[model samples]
Target: MPIQVGDKIPDVTVMTMTAEGPKPVKTSELFAGKKVALFSVPGAFTPTCSAKHLPGFVEKASDIRGKGVDEIVCIAVNDAFVMGAWGKSANAEGKVTMIGDGNGDLTKALGLEMDGSGFGLGMRGQRFSMIVDDGKVTHLNVEAPGAFEVSSAEYMLNQL
Candidate 1:
């Protein structure tokens, strides 16, 4: 089943780019003692993802953080390098934490994986966002396939 409000996020390894190189980060470590605004996109650099999805979070990072969120995270089912490049290109540095779920570990665990074989994108995370407090989900907004309404940063900020 898909993860919902009140569900504790599963412990899984996700990748983040570091000055040294790509590094593994545990999901539990990310949420431990923190209120996190975590958002996911279908893929990196895709039309909608680049033009709208990621930009929204980058633009509203401060407002989201101002509402008691300790961190704003952006995840995608791509490799760490790609995610890092996208983050740099989008000016997400110091604003958003970009994580790469290269193996779909976290996505699959949350039951949020979607097949994008028709587009040659293979398996990916659906477009969604959630407010997680100390590892427990408090709010969730999942967008319908190909739709982008409730998952935007503005909407998430309003929910907060």
Candidate 2:
């Protein structure tokens, strides 16, 4: 089953770009001792993802953070380099953390994987967002396929 409120985020390795290079982060450590606002895109740089999804978080980052969220994270089923470039292009530096689930390890662990073979995107994560407090999920908003309502930053902010 997919991850849900009250469940601890799964411990899996995900990548993040750094000055040195792509680095691995353990979900257990990343979510520990903090309230994290996390959202996932199917893939980086897609139309809806670029135009709406990621930007919403980037625009409302401070407002969201002000509500006691320790950090905001954006994840996609793409390589670290692509994620890094997307973050830079979207001006998400310092405002949002970009994570790359290149192998879909974290996505699969959460049971949020979706197939996009029709679009030639292969396996990817569904559009979703969640509030993780000290490693335990407190809220989860998963968008239906082809839908964009609940997972938006505005919706997440309202829940805060």
Candidate 3:
């Protein structure tokens, strides 16, 4: 089933890029005892993702945290190296936690996969954002195809 507003976040393991190298992070532990703002994008450094999606989160990271969030996570299907480089390029190395879902297991588990072969992009994640409180999803904002509706940091800030 697709993750719902009240569902307990699934606990899965993934190797996220860190300063030293790939580091293990469990999904449940990521949101444990905190308000987490987690967002996913199609790919790293994609047009929309670079210009608006991630930058919005970086720009509003402080305010989002001020609104009671403890962590801001930006996840993608790319590997740790690419994710790390993208985070640096996006100027979000410290502001957001970039988790690499190299195999798309995490994105698929979340029911947010988007096929982009026609665009020659291969497997990708749908653009979306969630406000998870203490491991339970409290808010979900999934964007329509070619649209950026419920996934912007500003929009979530208003909801908070």
Whole-model lDDT for model 3 versus the true structure? 0.90
Give RMSD (Å) of candidate 2 vs. truth: 0.5
Q: Which 10 residues in a row give candidate 2 its minimum summed lDDT? A: 2-11
lDDT of 3 at 77: 88
Lowest-sum lDDT 10-residue window in model 1: 151-160
Query: Taking the tens digit of each residue's C-alpha lDDT, what string does model 3 give over 22-57?
Result: 998888788899999999999998999999999999
Clashes of 1: 0
In candidate 2, stretches whose alpha carbon ends up further than 4 angstroms from where it belongs are: none
Q: Each model's TM-score?
A: 0.99, 0.99, 0.96
- Among residues 3 or more apart in sequence or in different chains, the pairs in candidate 3 whose N, CA or C atoms overlap within 3 Å are none
32-148 per-residue lDDT for model 2 (tens digits) = 899999999998999999999999999999999999999999999999999999999999999999999999999999999999999999999999999999999999999999999
* Candidate 2: pairs in clash: none
Whole-model Cα lDDT of every candidate shown, in order? 0.96, 0.96, 0.90
**Superposed model 3: Cα runs more than 4 Å off:** none
lDDT of each residue in 1-160, candidate 1, tens digit only? 9998999999999999999999999999999999999999999999999999899999999999999999999999999999999999999999999999999999999999999999999999999999999999999999999999999999998998
Window of ten residues with lowest summed lDDT in model 3: 10-19
Off by more than 4 A, model 1 = none
